[model samples]
Target: ERHRDMRRASSSLLGLAPRLLSGPRLCSRPLPLLAFARASQQRSGDAALALGEIRVADATGSLGVMTPKQALALAAERKLHLVEVAPNASPPVWKLLATLPVVEKRPEPPKIEEM
Candidate 1:
């Protein structure tokens, strides 16, 4: 009937095929994408310098291979931290880094009244 045909035609948008609506819905539904709402993306720093031998960079920009314990001891004697700078080189290079001193707030001096 013409009424049935008009109802079918009115249900679908103009120029859009009726088969598209009757088929499985894809655009109306969300895709299978994951949301990292509760996920943690941060990673802790891992020191490549261990007990094994590694190349260290001195003040003169020269490289020398030494055990991590020796380098660490040398850094400790100098009051510094041995940090690995180059990890992709033929031999990893280490550099000495100075740690910042923590500053604390001190109580104000007692007020003195002079006559």
Candidate 2:
């Protein structure tokens, strides 16, 4: 029907295709895809250096707080990378990341039972 086609077109345009095809949704309607696309996305690696002042933390506990520049210098001295762990905090929290080697393990073949 013309009405159904129009509804589908409008829903798809508003990023509501999932709700239309799916039976029911637990959460409220999703925001438009464009809203997310336009928002600022999280950066990585050296980008943490631009986060101004940040709090440094580790497995042992909080390592105290410092400016990004100082923290980066310390991280370099320790042979680690400054990674933003929690960006929503007051000044955001950064962690020291150390590179580790990756190991791949393959599974052994199953044994065959003789008749």
Candidate 3:
């Protein structure tokens, strides 16, 4: 009598067929890839000269003082971009170029002093 009651309860629970104790399950819809990117992009604006007084340099590397707007106008006149090369200077240094600068690889130091 006791064993038969336990069998009935076990069969009733198996009929539920829920995946709580089972393996993984897939979602109904996939998540967007650029959801966070689109949200944060509007906050930072452009990566180039976007704020404060900036020091600009032309192709010849001649430095000059100007507001950010003036620097941008000069960049637009030459169909180039105003990229910030050095941001830690007294007033940040910017350059006019068609595109971003390429980073060159540095050579390794000598190993003579090593043990």
Model 2 vs. true fold: TM: 0.47
Q: Report lDDT per candidate.
A: 0.57, 0.66, 0.60
User: What is every candidate's alpha-carbon RMSD to the true fold?
Assistant: 20.4, 9.3, 19.9
Runs of candidate 2 with Cα error greater than 4 angstroms are 1-45, 100-115
Model 3 residue runs over 4 Å out of place are 1-50, 102-115
Predict model 2's lDDT versus the native: 0.66
Per-residue accuracy of model 1 over 28-87 as CA lDDT, tens digit each: 532332212212321111354443667876566755887777777777788876665555
Task: Evaluate model 3: give its lDDT.
Answer: 0.60
TM-score of 1: 0.41
Model 3 per-residue lDDT tens digits across residues 17-46: 323323243462223333222323221114
TM-score for each prediction? 0.41, 0.47, 0.45
Query: Using lDDT as the measure, what is the rank order of every candidate, best first?
Result: 2, 3, 1
Tens-place lDDT per residue, model 2, 3-114, is: 5687677778977765444443346443433321221443335776767778897657788878878887887898876666677888888777685223346788999999
